[model samples]
Target: MSTTHQPTPATARPVGPPTKHQLAVMIWVAVFPTLTVLNLALGDWLGTLTPVVRTFVLATIAVPIVIYGLMPQLHKLRVRLLSRA
Candidate 1:
């Protein structure tokens, strides 16, 4: 009689790609309405501002906020992807 252990496949972990159902729900919940609202709202607000002011405001507020918000997550993802490759 013998005892043995086998490693599970990496895919066995409940990480990585979203399922089809999850992707569909994510699109409905996050993508569709946000895109429509952003386009409508930003179009109106940008139209109200002069082009130089619009550029300045967007650069001052939106760009920094977006970069700060996204950079850590993007760095983590980059490390993970590069390690995998």
Candidate 2:
């Protein structure tokens, strides 16, 4: 007697990791905020010279905001990937 096995089609495959573009976006989304906070801390510690420079420096807070917004989504993605393995 012989046994045979078959695999499902591509469309049947489970959705997994974020695509390359999504991964890139995710990384940028995560990193931007962290970098922003870093920039702000540096600016404050070093004391930027002008109002325009300060405004730009303050904009670094957006890094945490962006990251906070994405945390849930990233967490969800992480859980899905881990469970699959």
Judged by TM-score, which candidate is best?
A: 1
lDDT of each: 0.55, 0.64
lDDT of 1 at 40: 69
**CA RMSD of each candidate after superposition:** 9.4, 9.1
The residue-level lDDT of candidate 2 at 80 comes to 67
lDDT of 1 by residue, 28-55 (tens): 5543454455546687787788989876
Worst 10 residues of 2 by lDDT: 4-13
lDDT tens readout by residue for model 2, 1-85: 7575443455344556667887787778776776666666776664745767655655555545556766567858765665555
Model 1 stretches with alpha carbons more than 4 Å out: 1-40
Misplaced by over 4 Å in model 2 are 1-14, 44-85
What lDDT, from 0 to 1, does candidate 2 have? 0.64
For all predicted structures, in order, the TM-scores are: 0.48, 0.39
